[model samples]
Target: MSDTLLKPHPLDEATYLRSLGPGRLAGRTSAAYWNMAGPFGGTTAAILLRAVMEHPDRRGRPVAQTVNFCAAVAEGEFEVLVRLVRDGRSTQHWLVELVQGDVVAATASTVTGPSRETWSHRPGAPPPMPPSQALAPLPTEGRNAWLGRYEFRFERGEPIPGRASAEAPAPALSRAWVRDAPPRPLDYVALAALADTFVVKILQVRGDIPPVATVSMTTYFLADEAEMARQGEDYLLCTADARAFKHGFNDQTAELWSAGGELLAVSNQVVWFKG
Candidate 1:
């Protein structure tokens, strides 16, 4: 009957945290967002951000977060250790770590601060793309469990069906309409996860799913809570691209845009792939 007892959506359930003590919270992995090896890295990042959001000392909204995947997180209980690094008049900084027993599985640095009214401009525009309704949703029934958690309609790059033998590599770019499968209103938490949903750029460029892991990912939230809520359940025009792949590492950058063309978030990551 209390708000605390309400059952959250699958995405929220995956990222849900329960206060344990000062600066600590408990959570568990969910089957809904399972990836090839572990829970989706995005969910991991979201939960870390959630810890900070729920912290008593938190201020403002999420400005940015950098999640570093230290090791594979096994499905089970985990503890998040949240440290309030500093709280300034306008900005709050935090350090968070996800611990599985004795080992730290992931760590994050986050910034939360109020957005002030100011002159703003973005030079780049959301790339042109057909309406989300114009394309068929990517099939997800038999793919990774996490794939079913979202709806993806590609306007430009879709992952190759399988390995490709083309002598030339495809351009490492994809533009698509993306949103939660069950249609949750946009929020910083949802935006954080959506920012990670771009099919890893290596799959888009090389046409093969290799043994890959995102070692580090950083997301910058541009839209404030009111702006995100105004998006309702509309799909975000999301895009991802890679600059280079060499020496077993690849660089990827992505942008998420609201249906009305507001830039919601920007993300970049370093991926390690094995042939």
Candidate 2:
């Protein structure tokens, strides 16, 4: 095969790893997902999860993952160390750390397990939105590189910096159709990264970028492998909103629904900010 055909996709390249030893791997940040001060938080989370998923003892699929941003990850090589906290018959718990030099830049915990057949129901329905083709994708030219990685079609609450002020605070709510720009198939690693694409909820309310960092984020994957496979290259309906912004911190929640209206994932995050 030609080398060109063997090349990895940008997302795969960004999350690619080289095993240094058991439970330890090496990776480098990608410019494609760079943010203001460091790599985009989503890609950071994706690589950390990738470390665990690539582990030999890993079982089942991703069920839940929580990542804590301890320090801004500088662009360059880093190390991911994964530890199997507990390996149960039905569930496996993992602890992972992303280290650049001696400083621990980020840490994460993940849960993976097999699914059992049982009765299920989804009471909450996907929010109403026109088909993805009906709306234009958010323009990304000359914006943050990460913003261009995904195609977003806002149904409501397009972020306009400085739209909110003390006298009038806009609600921090948004609903949109979102998918990877190059249309990658849905999977746990991609889903984990996509879960973090929402603009911070506080940004929606304040309508501006502040000195903000996501301190912690948790995502729960509801779909199994078969479910994710069925969602190939299709837009997922995504919605994000925040309840309050005070004490230099805020919280946001989001939901991702498949094109067919099945709830795919739910994510919540806590962010610290400064004026």
lDDT of each: 0.90, 0.90
Tens digits of per-residue lDDT for model 2, 100-143: 99999999999999988989987999988999989888898888
Model 1 TM-score?
0.95
**Cα shift from native, residue 109, model 1 (Å):** 0.3
Q: List the residue pairs that clash in candidate 1.
A: none
> Backbone collision count in every prediction?
0, 1
Error of 2 at 205 (Å): 1.3
**Candidate number of the best TM-score:** 2
Model 2 worst lDDT run, 10 consecutive residues = 199-208
Cα lDDT tens digits for candidate 1, 1-275:
97745767789889989989999999999999999999998899889999998898898999999999999999999999999998899899999999999999999999999989999888979998888999999999988999999999998888865544336578888899999978888888888889899877777777777899999999999998778888999999999999999999999999999999999999999999997
What is the clash tally of candidate 2? 1
